[model samples]
Target: MRFTRRKSTLWRTFESRYYVMTLLTPLGLLGLIGILVLIIIYIIRPNFQQKVVSSTYVWKLSLKYRKKRLPTSKLRDLLLIICQILVLASCAFIIAKPACIVKSTETNSETVIIIDSSASMLMSSNGKTRFERAVEAAGTKAGEVLDGGGEVTVITAGPKAEYLCEKETKENKESVLREIKGLWNDNQNDIKCTYGSDDIDGAMTLCADTVADNPKANVFIYTDATYVNGSVPEGVNVIDVKGEEESNAAIINATVTQDQNNYVFSADVIRYGTENTPLSLKASFYGVNDKSGENGKLTFELKDIPVVANETYRITFRKDVEYTDEDKLRGYKLVEESKLVLCKLVADTDVTTDEEYGVYSFEQVMFDIAESDAFDFDNHYFIYGGKKEKLKVLYVTTPIDKNGKGEENPFVPAALSIAKNYFSSRLDIEVDTVMSDKQYLLTGYNMYIFEGLKPDSMPVDGVTFLINPPKGDYKEYGFDLGLEITSKGSEGDTLSSNSSNKLLDGLKAEDITVSKATSLKNFTGSDDSPYNYESLLELNGSTVAIARNCKENQTVVMSFSTHYSNIAYGHIAVLMTNIIDYYFPATVSGTKLEVGGKIEINARGASVIARESGFTQEEFTLTEFPATLVLTRPGQYVISQTTYFGQDLTDTIYVSIPQSESALTEERYSLENPFTERDDSDYFNDLLVYLAAALVALLFVEWWLHSRESM
Candidate 1:
């Protein structure tokens, strides 16, 4: 496209003519008027006036001579006059610097350049990333098109197709180059190169749509050709700018295991090149001292290990650093300080050798260590060195047989014991059985399990479970038990079809035989009542099980006794386990997280600080429980939290990069006319120069013709 638009209205009016000329200056018009005046005066005025009265007699004869001679001689004079007029007109036209607006039959085609800016493009070689090179190549092509009198459109293929510049001409070429330079800088610094994948196909589709109306349009794609395959659009070209391949070693996997007092760290390394290289596996441990101070760094290195090309090698390291009394005290302080048992693996090498074909190479590949629970290791583990605390559960039951033999309901306690064993590996649960008549304080327990007994007053703290309580008007405790007894046949009432509740996960009501059950009709604690209660199990419009939250305490009420129902013992055991685990979930120290993945945590009023390998730290405050956190980088992240109880919690999470991105090999795709040249230079200036020269030649010819006629 031309940079400037013609004065179209005036030019179009003169379309009937081959060429149209317009004066740029008013002086040119004045020159034309002066020439017209001279020509008129020369023709109309007499050169001389003599005594014509004396020749009156001869005047008739003179008229006869003048009439015949003037007709023949006037033709020569007219030729001279015409030549003079021609010279003047040509001079005036040249002074006006007239620009002829010639309509062309052929239209310039459009050119679209698409560049990839995905994460894979960020792989650098020779001090430049693939993205930088792609941008440069695209910019060069755009410049060529703009110079050839064609329009250019630049698109960046990122997570989405982004238009950098659209429908730009040679006049806007500088602006287009400036935008491309910005992308180059951003890619170099890895500032906004956050796109994980490329959308080249989508970008190409967009380009096709952009040029749908123009048959002569062409599309160029500049990328590493990592994601290019299959069919391409007509008139589309792909430029594969992939660089030479370099040898690289990446940590494919990592894990930690405990053996007695020793902690073992294992990692799998893979080499992607054809040459063997010497590799180093470095492990760094950040331990906490008793005073919550830095306990000095512990580094273990496996150096000069022979790593074969195109092979996977496993390396393992174990250490048994004993934890003294001071270490245990420091473990407690570590929790308060939000310090985690941090461990990191970094793969490196000392070899400075270069490959013959590679443009650039990396000497280090930091391994992302997988995170494990603090208790997964032995007691001497960094954060779990101290003696672990057990959850205290108080079980209160009334005597079922009050005839001198003081025996309590054994089914409920047996279920509780079974549930306790299920979670023994995660956390220790201590169950203390107490008779209903025994005086016991509820403050010391983490959970209270009541069997066939109603407390005088509900505990305002901790989790409580009530089973088959007698009828009572416990208005003070926000519950009024009903005295109605409902009996079912040998077959129990069918479980609600809506059994999506977590409490009824494995237990099915159809399998149970409930001979008798109490209906919770008088238990009025819901939205319509003074208390809040959520019905868990409902049969015939009556609630058989309900849950209530009073202040910070959780209470679950069941209307039937486990002894009366012939429900599977395993099902009852699982129900009991689900109830305890639901109320007081196990503390999760850390988890294995992938890059660009999200992790949800349920610790209210806690601070989450994540620290990466390069000392990059990010802090987030969760005002409520179940906050979502996204891991963006691949490395070890120490996630520390401070609970509402002034207790510090620490967890370690590892974010790993995808395997596809780790293979730093460039792929090739077929391209048509990848290196086609462009014609972008405008011809208006050259045309103007030739026009000026032609006008000068015409003026010379007019002068020569007038002189010859005068002679």
Candidate 2:
């Protein structure tokens, strides 16, 4: 039941609050207080009005009127109270500004920094390597999160996927920024993620898998426009950075090749864009002649390339061509490998009858083998840097006619036919056909095929066949098949009649199994010393199948030709394949490329040891070596090093370089995620808005408090 009344005063009616900065701008508080005092006395005073009231009974009503009109603190104490509220509000607002600068608790935070280290990142995009600028920009934003006490994980997006910083330990601004400064677009720098081939598809999956384990975590991906072709992970924030220039075209194709002559080389060229893209092509062929001058320069005829696109050309060389090709397209031949090349061919004519019915087929066989290779030199005459795909055959025939007449021409006709048959078949072996005639001597072949030709003149160069030569010369020309020498040689190495060659006096039951040699009837006791092979079809007096020896090379001698028996043809072909596979060997030059290559290759139990520019030499040792070896360049390779028993052998890898500019456009963009937003994006803007609102509200409160204090 309190009653009160008052006459309105200018200072009492208007309240002017004062602003005081406690620690900062303390002088500002004094100026604000002075203005408040002035406003209350001068500006507010002239407008002051008075209301009069009287008697005690009226005062009671006046008290209710006062409470209704005022509804505030004691008017007598209003000046002090207003001064206190104004000073406090100023301090409170300044402190509250920090809250506006920060964000709400996002709970667990996943900050992924996807740095672009692709080839395009090397270009100056926005004044720096797109990579360099990206790292700087990412660092600034990472600070905001770390400043807010959140954790961060830094990732790298390049040809190799990696993590520069793990999402471990409490995030520190200094440490994060420090890591950013040391960050490099190289492997030795980012060792956490082992480098693999460029496969962004897998990398995208990895990015998602990394954070998917922790649900409700926010993801921030920062990168350049290299990842245009790649997909962004789910629930990820993408902060994309784009460079100012995307117009540079670089040479992406550099490849190596192997030719028919076993020569190796590499070629690369640049393409130009017709736009204001003033470009240069500088090719330094390493591991070869260092002609740094324009002497090695090669220019192209194409011109006016489209913007961001280029017209490309090539530079090529080989080992056999002359060093001077200034006028030719294929220039500068490397040194040639000596060509003491050995060649051979097999005749289709089979001869494995107990008797000698020799018809010569050497001429026809030689002619066909040469003609078959005419289509492409690589198919037919690839030299012996290694071996080619063809069996090595040993054709042994006598120059005597079926009737034993010494007609050289007649015997040769049938001999040549035999050669054709054997050559076309699996005996598709390379052979040196020895002739008794002075006109045609054995040359250029690895194994010898004697067709009734005198074994006397045949050198020990290859396998020799003595057609039932009176076991005399056998001591020097053959292996000892019997327990002892049947006859002795005049000289230790002479293939004369006295050569040690013998047959067992008596045949044992197992000498030739009846089942294994059904054809051997009356020929059983005949001296089988001339032939020493696992018999395929043996007849009584002689064998249609046998094995022979000349030095380390094992030769099989059959007693009949296809002219003698059709049955021998089957065994002949089988033995031919086996023998050829044994002798005609193949050598491999492993995969070779410029250091950083596209397609990596490997062969069975082998490694590329030496590489001079483009030539990768892959070596393999002989284990039941085959007589032929073949290879193709720029291919998906499957190399094998298996023993004759198919046991495991050594294995090595080779890789081919990508060609220049063919698909320089094929390798698409890098890992730039435009859809992935930065964790502190428009959020920073939101903070700014809060700071602005807080500052404005602060001004009004202080002004009102000062006006009251002045009264």
Candidate 3:
């Protein structure tokens, strides 16, 4: 607003810095010639002839008129000459051009404005995202610096530090504004405004380097200060732009489980901020058929849901939707043809209010009934309603026991039956006993237990348990079953067992008593061998029970025979259940992945598709067996693929906002003298147009006076 002439050696020579020197030269020359011509014309008077008058009285009147005319005409001519000279001089000066420089005593400072672009910046209040507010704050700071003739550098801190506009001058401030306002474009792939985990260290490093290069430079960071925990660079000022606290409710955890032939959906919802008002939450369930078509829908509304700040509330919904024939057909196709039964759970705010200061939030979570099993808040869960497949166990025994009775050990079958019933609530288990010499097939059995006998050859693939096997019989199955037998009535008491092993579930060393047993020495392999079995139970430093898993086939060896031991009625039942559960785990545990993280899954040359609740679906094709998927947003994602067996497989994964971003608490920081003084004289404006207007007014005044004199 304020302008003054700057004092400089170059400016002193030019006199006016706003105009071209070449144009001023010709205009000055023309003005000088016009002034000389006017002076010559005034000095050289024209010759005139005298005229006779009628009488002496006429001569007197004519003399009086001539006197009046001479004074008036002389005044007019003087005024006209002065006006012409003024016009000529003004024209020459206007052509030379003039400029007014802004006056300031402050020194110019280079400034860098860093804006936080993390996912936390997406928090909205008053219909504006935190990032939008931060950008506006940054623009204000840039304007102040630019107005003072200081250069500005705008940097955005996202997954990495990026420069939006570098070293922008006051003349190009508009360009910087455009870049900041248009940070997010139509293309989501553009990383300029993509939401990601905050990388404050990376951004701070960039600021540190900038300050190191220019020791006196000013750096201003604009953010909500939610994720900033580490040290900041020296001379950097942080401007907190966070607004008032806004209440939000998030579905932190969701799970689906089957109970009594019905699917139960449960969710853990947490409220943030200080508002203790009750929020109405609506839960909707959408069932998709085999062709990915919606068939059945169920809606549940919970009004006046009491929610305490920072507290979690549990919400449950049972299967209330009546399925039609089409829905049943879709479920049947999902189980038989490998299609997927899709279930989507959406949560939203029931009441919409126009409160300016209050925040009404909603979140939707999706689940697939066919693909999910594990209970996790960060991933979608699937509930399988179909009957579980039974585990087939092949129990092989010798024709005759040492008792000389043809009947096998009753405790063996009793223990198997007890273990089978224990898991019957969740799993189906079937045990088939056969003689070792019988022509039995091991194709469909999931497990093989050998009692005092060995198979002709080891089962190609399955879990196998060897109980009291003869040393010579195990040699053919690549097992070094070296057993050292003592007297006939020899007994070995259990010394110690691995507590971490699931197989030793309820069995204690004192509870196990083997009346007739042999010591297993070097049973698995040599001491220096790398393929040794892990000992599950030990007696006096000798292995009583050891197990090993090789190429998906788990094998267990027990030195004592169950026929002579009381382990059958004791923890043996629990041990059998543990072994069955271990080999056939309910769910395959995968790597824990977070929001905006990457994970690799087996695709098997099938098309993999992933979709979040209320978002567009993304599809990927595997060139190889496994492909990597990048999670960009937080929600329940249903990932589906087809296997070579013509079975459709789908998985549900849940991703949640990071704890650091969800907390929504502001951090305070302090600094001393973070900004430097800026010089404001560089943006001087030209005054040539004002000078030209003044010259035109003078010409009009001169013409008006001349016309009045003639009248």
State the lDDT of candidate 1 residue by residue for 59-105, as single tens digits. 87887876777665677667656656765766666566655434332
Pairwise TM-score winner, candidates 2 and 3: 3
Question: Could you give candidate 3's per-residue lDDT for residues 239-290 as a string of tens digits?
Answer: 7666676655565555656455344566665556787765445555544211
Q: Whose lDDT is greatest here?
A: 3
Off by over 4 Å in 2: 1-106, 116-148, 154-165, 171-197, 215-243, 246-433, 436-608, 611-711
Candidate that would win on TM-score: 1
- The regions of model 3 sitting more than 4 angstroms off are 1-112, 123-129, 132-183, 192-219, 225-249, 255-265, 269-313, 318-441, 470-472, 480-484, 487-515, 518-546, 565-633, 636-651, 659-711
lDDT (10s digit) by residue, model 2, range 608-627: 22222223344423333222
Each model's number of backbone clashes? Answer: 8, 102, 8
- How much is 677 displaced in model 1, in angstroms? 24
Number of clashing residue pairs, candidate 3: 8
RMSD of each: 18.5, 23.4, 24.0
Would you estimate the TM-scores of all the predictions? 0.59, 0.38, 0.49
Which candidate do you rate higher for lDDT, 1 or 3? 3
